[model samples]
Target: DQQVKQNSPSLSVQEGRISILNCDYTNSMFDYFLWYKKYPAEGPTFLISISSIKDKNEDGRFTVFLNKSAKHLSLHIVPSQPGDSAVYFCAASVHAGGTSYGKLTFGQGTILTVHP
Candidate 1:
């Protein structure tokens, strides 16, 4: 079973528009959530994260909202740019273990296409 899932395989949007990516998880034990952006030939870069204790976290043009009760989370990018055209992966991890050594379970990834 997929612990985490990004239902959309890809999304397309016009430049300067908003881009929304969705994710869902089934494990209630997951306490930490993260979003990573990846470009061709490069490793994924951490975009935003939120703990189970919080509902939302934002950084500049990127914002992540978590709805714990629904087991859902989303990443919103305002004024999406061509540079943002890449794959986005949503990950989840449990922090019950000391040192936060648990591996992050990633979604299938969603490719965002920004047309200029």
Candidate 2:
């Protein structure tokens, strides 16, 4: 069962504040973690990622931390802006055997609203 879980359905925060999103996974074999940001109708765009071997990864205003022992991960956005209001999805994937390559398992998604 490849189930990635984002328990929170939505979050609201003020501009210039820190916004945090949480995610969990039940599949222990997932070795790669990714965070994607999406607008209303467009497909999710890759934001940041971390490997199972690393504890954290940061890219400019965004940071992602992973804890393999707990099967948990979090995304942090610093100085959130109103333009950042969108849905965020946490995805996990593992290298497939054979020629399947990598497949992603996505969570239900978390809608974040950054107010001005």
Candidate 3:
């Protein structure tokens, strides 16, 4: 069963616009997180992440906020560009027993298209 899910299958936006990607998780045990972006033939790479202890994490133009009570999270990309067009995935991991396991569960992914 998929513990995380990206409800939006696709999103389109013009260049310089803000792109918002949303995700939700069913497992309360998930405490770690990541957002992976994949372009064309390249492998997925880490985009942004938020720790369970914090509600928001921002890096440059990308920001991710976690709502622990709601079991939801969202990624915000400001000034979307054509180069930003790609597949974005929401991922999460569980931290337990005083150890942080690197195992991650990923969502189905949402295709974002940024038109010039």
Model 2 TM: 0.94
The regions of model 3 sitting more than 4 angstroms off are: 97-100
> Which should have the higher TM-score, number 2 or number 3?
2
Relative to the true structure, how large is the alpha-carbon lDDT of every model?
A: 0.96, 0.94, 0.94
lDDT of 2 by residue, 1-116 (tens): 54899999999999999999999999988899999999987999999999999999999999999999999999999989999899999999886685536888899999999999
Instruction: Assess the local accuracy of residue 76 in candidate 2 as a C-alpha lDDT between 0 and 100.
Output: 96
Off by over 4 Å in 2: none
How far in Å is the alpha carbon of 14 misplaced in model 1?
Answer: 0.8
TM per candidate: 0.95, 0.94, 0.94
TM-score result, candidate 3: 0.94
Better of 1 and 3 by TM-score: 1
Which tens-of-lDDT digit does each residue in 12-116 have in candidate 1? Answer: 999999999999999998999999999999999999999999999999999999999999999999989999999999999997777657889999999999999
Model number with the top lDDT: 1
Give lDDT: candidate 3, residue 53. Answer: 95
